[model samples]
Target: MPERELTFAQAVREALAEEMRRDSHVCIFGEDVAEAGTPFKVLSGLVEEFGGDRVVDTPISEAGFTGVAVGAAMTGMRPVVDIMFGDFLTLTMDQMVNQAAKVHYMSGGHWKVPMVMRTTLGATRRSAAQHSQSLHAWFSHVPGLKVVLPSTPYDAKGLLKTAIRDENPVVFFEDKMMYKLKGPVPEEEYTIPLGVAEVKREGDDITIVATSSMVQVGLGAATLLEKEGISAEVIDPRTTWPLDDKTLIESAKKTSRVIVLDEGYGRYGVTAELAAVIAEGAFYDLDAPVKRMGAMHVPIPFSPPLEDVTVATEETVFEAARQLCGKT
Candidate 1:
């Protein structure tokens, strides 16, 4: 269990490197992954180790390359497909939803797709609407797809390894805000199992369920709530698709109230999903109705101040929690 401090991007690169070295079937294909090594340097030096044939640099055709990756996965290759930005996933939705996700299930579980779809998300750099978005919600809504978001270096490495080896097509989201944040990650290899929720903080007053970048914001808000004598429990649903509703429901039953914070839009996004699930599973334990806070349903703005308002943050989480606890 030896550990080293590394940024989120470095952790992702390490996971890919380790997987590629261990399995010959593991190949990476993405635009600029070979030469430019990705905008966040997540694939830096991978081409040198795995060579150009394995670390392929595809054209800008997301649809074509994604479909190609799906076909490769079906035939026994474990391809780590990288979409430059989560926003561009829309172009390959048909291939991902109809093909990659559904193929194995449609085939009566006889076939398995061990493919990982890696993409960068969030708007910390002000990349605007086209390049910046938290679209895990989209992938989560589709059945047969696994969605994962790692907020720390350790989880980033372990979850990516799990996604690479998983039997189903997984959409792995790396929040741009976490790319530079450093944390303790193991030197030896490890994999975090999917369909699990990690309770980062435990408390009895209120429960905060967050995903992706909002995990950090929820933690920050939890600290402030602690000072005000409001104990806050924070839960990160690391994998969104097969969400660990049992853990969340148990926590909510103890606390009797829940607030869901998400980086995606408020309407029909990750937050919406959590709220719906809690309402369904833990309705009797509620002191008040479940609450959700997230970015407005509009496109991400460019200005820093505007972006601050558009995305969920500590203020938003605090207000939502306060309202749920009857302290607002």
Candidate 2:
């Protein structure tokens, strides 16, 4: 029998549905999340299955609803707040950073904020600056929050399940452009633990450490590099906060050359932190300094051609890796 496949959106929906069925506390809160199924239609039919009480929709108030979700989680509810766009995370910073993140710690470990906030990231969607920001690194910087970046449909399903059941606050960022991207997923219920890194491809010449949407970018670059006799390893740090630094450092040690790729800005971004980690962990073993590639540090443009150049691509990564490996 052929392995079943699911799009990234479908996988997310399945995870939410299964969790809701298993636990009545697992509810959804966001704008148009109930009947409209969200802007991307990823939540279609969920409200019907779970009903309005569970898959509840609220007014277009991110800060307001996020505060409600935090309170709900603290009071024995596993609430999932959908923030639509990752850029809107700014509005909920106080609730997330000041409240939800510190509730358990401030309460001497008595209070728990088991909440999940789902949002979309990535550029090149033509959504312009306001809607097209990849800001996962912002949440990763917070100590009490777990930041999840699922690169594939399988990862999307498993990691989401884990996030919903986590004991701490979890911020889940999805690439809006990848909702329809398809990949094999198991029918059995399973959850991928946070903080684990998956080595998608193995190689000896160089290591490409990528997160979220950039995982595919790294894979594509690996394929291109293969033709040039450059064996590039691709590793996906599924969660940025509880990052699998050991795996990333080991890969850097083996390859001796490293490239950290992400959709966020390079400076003070996920790419910079990962590069630093690899440099610190594997400095003696490395042959070259770690390289960082990310979105251009500018407001993502509305123009198609200009926006396309802001983020890393397979060709760009291929060229960078080739040069780092002295292929040129």
Candidate 3:
């Protein structure tokens, strides 16, 4: 299969279009998703291709539309519900946590809520506190929900397709800052299996486990580490829930040093969870403490300078790696 360069948002749109074409049951609904094509224009022109019936533009009611999607999924429709902003997800907690997530388990496996809840995360676009957030950890803590945060265009397309086909409710998070980021994506059909992790770069000196946009930041840090003669391995846990612990544990065992990075708050966030998993599974492999880096606990500010300080950057990651390698 030949590969072509595509932005992260374009890859996501391709996945949605391809899945809708493959399955008559698949449909997408959200605020401004049809004619307006979303603020990012990811769904631009999709409504024209699929028609308004399949590509719906709903009222600005997160709870109402989310509930409708859940009900539709129960009746055999694969509905992709888009939450324009991660903060808006708070309004649909009942539909997401209680109903959609637990329907299959509550029904003794007789029913399934095969739905995808896609939302944008991260800070840096000056969207302010309401629109900028990395809340994957909140959903990951829920048992019945599958949490996925894809870092690259390839993973974004493949994982989203898999999420749409999944039998369980999937909370698919997209880093808002990565929308224009481009990468190679094959034209051929493909679906990356859920609960799997990918090793973006292999090394033996230390390991950097990152999520969403942090994966790119970690890779940049690894490049700097290389100049200092430090071989830093990079791992992206594509899905937060049912994380690919095997790959992470093996990498920790090989490197014996780990730095977990995320865009969520550092306190009790996804990085903390990854550190716990590594300590529990590979406690004997540790040469030093597992360092975790994430955004500061303050609300994301609208000011560019303050926002830059709040979120993790390549320099922050690079310094974390240096300190772990005893070079700082």
Candidate 4:
């Protein structure tokens, strides 16, 4: 079969469609899934094909629907619930953190909530505070939830497929800025297992570990660093909860310096988590303190320039890496 390229949004829709077709118990429920098909149109045309019973549309009550989905998952069906914005996940924490995440462990291995909570994270187009937040770290801090953030179209489809098929609750975060991003995805069915990191670019001076939208910025920084005769290695964890610490630590050890970038706040966020892991695991290998670049500790501003300054960008990644390499 011929391989076809697809946008990140298309890849997600394809994965959900294929999974629903393969498993009768697999159903999707979320606000606007039936008509608006989500703000990114990830569920576009799904209701028409799968019917309303399977591709359900819920009310604006995120907490209520989240609990309902958790109950459904524990009973028999596998429900993929969409919460629209990553920030809104806070509203459903009761069901997600207490119920869905801990059900399998609380049941002593007798039962599990094999649910996928789909959400979008990023600060593009000025979505503001309520809609623009990267809460992957929050979910990763919890014990039972599996967090996956895919940077490429291929990983997005594959990881999402894995999340839907896995025997645990998975929090799948897609960056809104990357929805229209294009890449080559397999024309056939495939799945990228969680907990594996991809080395997007290889270098020797320093390792840059990033997630979600920061991956693109990291790559761009690597390009600029190369021109300055500094070789920078870039690693994408792909999945946040089951982080590929081994790969990341080894990369940092090889380079002897590191820069961790994220789209979330710096304090107690994914960047901090990764920095702690590298510091604990590869303390001897580091020649200097690991640096982190992230959004400022403030709500995403509506002003484009202010939003640009607050969020992670190519310049931010580059300058941080420069400081780590003693060039700044």
Candidate 5:
């Protein structure tokens, strides 16, 4: 299959189109998703293609539409519910956490809520504190829910296809800042299994584990570190929960130095989980204390300068890698 260049949003739209075509049971519902095509326009023309029945536009009530999606999934339909912003996920916790996530387990595997909750995260769009936030950590802590954070176009498309087919409910998070970022994607069909981690770059001096948009930052840091005689390995844990521990633990054991990066708040966030995993699985191979970098513990500010300081950047990740490698 030949690969073509596609922006992150295009890749996601392609996945949804292909999945909806392949499965009659698959449907989508969200605010401004049908005719309006969403704020990012990722769903533009999809409603025209699949018609209003499959591609639906719901009201502004997150909890109400989310419950409807869950109910639809329970009845053997695969519903893709799109939350316009990550912050709005808090409003649908009852439907998501208490209902959708528990139905399969509570029913003793007799029923399954094979649903996909797609939402956007990160700050920099100036959407302000309410619209811009990375809350994947909150969902990752919940059992019976699969958390997916795709950083690249290829992963975004493939992982989403897999999520739509999953028996358990999946929380799919797309970085809002990466919508226009382009990467090569195959025209042919593919599905990247959950719980698999990818090594974006390989080295031996230090290991850098990053999630979502921070994967790109980690890559940038690795490129700069290379010129300074430091070889940094970069890993992207595509799925937050049920993380591919083998890949991360092996990398940490090989490099003996690790730095975990995330766009979420640093305190008690995804970085903390990765750091703990590395420390527990590869303690004997440690060379230096594991470092973590993420957004500060505060609501993302509306000011460009203030918001810029809150999130992790390539420079911050590079500096963290330098200090860990003793090159600073």
Candidate 6:
């Protein structure tokens, strides 16, 4: 059978639709989600299939609906709240960090908050600073929350299903710029467990550990490195919180050099944590200090030129890896 292909948005919609059909408890809450299917239209036609009650359209209040979703999850419904923009995540931090994250722990494992928050990250849509930010690191820092960043259609669908079924709260981050990216997705049911890393490309020269959207950039950089007689391994830690440190450590051990990449800010970000993990695990077997590449430490710009420089690109990763391997 020919492998079926789906865009990232289609994969997300399929994941939600499948989960909703399989479990009545799974529902969505977001502005215009019921009728408009969100600005991205990832949820189009879902209300027709599941009805308005389950595919709820909320007011223009991120905090209000997020709080409601938390309560709903505590009561037994598996609520998937949608924050239209990732920058707006600041509005839902309290609910996510204090209430949802500590519920089971405070209750001594007596209560479970089976909730999921889906939001978009990445720039270049001219959405400006208020709408563009990759804030997954904040949620990952918390003890109980699971942070998922799916880079491709397959990972998006599979990771989402797993997040929806998880007993604890999960924050799913999607690259808004990649909703239309095409990739192969199987028609059969599948779920990718949180905290596991997948090596997109295997090599012996260096390891590039990338998260979320940076995975694609890392792969491109690997291709460039390969042409220069430099081998690069690319690993994607699909989820940030329950991170797969072992796989990352082993990759670093094999390659001896590593570069950590993400779309978030470089200072005290996911890249730092990943680099620390690699250093801690494979310190004895070393070639160079793990380099970190990420978004510039500033509010995302609306200008094409300014915004272009802020994000990590294939060329940037390639240069960083080449320099790390002493090729440049």
lDDT tens digits, residues 116-232, model 6? 999999877888999889988899899999999999999999999999999999999999989999999998999999989999999999999998889999999999999999999
Ranking by lDDT: 2, 6, 5, 3, 4, 1
Candidate 4 local distance difference test against the native: 0.91
In terms of lDDT, which candidate is stronger, 3 or 4? 3
Error of 3 at 178 (Å): 0.7
lDDT of 2 by residue, 1-328 (tens): 8999999999999999999999999999999998999989999999999899999999999999999999999999999999999999999999999999999999999999999999999999999999999999899999899999999999999999999999999999999999999999999989999999999999998999999899999999999999999899999999998999999999999999999999999989999999999999999999998999989999999999999999999999999998899878
Evaluate model 1: give its lDDT: 0.90
The C-alpha TM-scores of every prediction are: 0.97, 0.99, 0.98, 0.98, 0.98, 0.99
lDDT per residue (tens digit) for residues 123-216 in model 1: 8688888988888889998989999998888899999999998889999999977888999986776799998999999999999998888889
Q: Pick the winner on TM-score between candidates 3 and 6.
A: 6
- Model 6 is weakest, by summed lDDT over 10 consecutive residues, at 123-132
Taken over the whole model, the C-alpha lDDT of each candidate is 0.90, 0.96, 0.93, 0.91, 0.94, 0.94
Which candidate should be chosen as best, given lDDT against the real structure?
2
lDDT tens readout by residue for model 3, 1-328: 4569999999999999999999999999899999999988989988999999999999999999999999999998999999999989999999999998889999999998999999989999899999998888989989899999999999999999999999889999999889999999988899999899999999999999999989999999999889989999999989998799999999999999999999999899998999999999889989999999988999999999998999778888888788888886
Candidate 5 — worst ten consecutive residues by lDDT sum?
Answer: 319-328
The residue ranges of model 5 lying beyond 4 angstroms of the native Cα positions read: none
Candidate 1 C-alpha error for residue 187, in Å: 1.3
> Which stretches in model 2 have alpha-carbon errors above 4 Å?
none
Alpha-carbon runs more than 4 Å astray in model 3: none
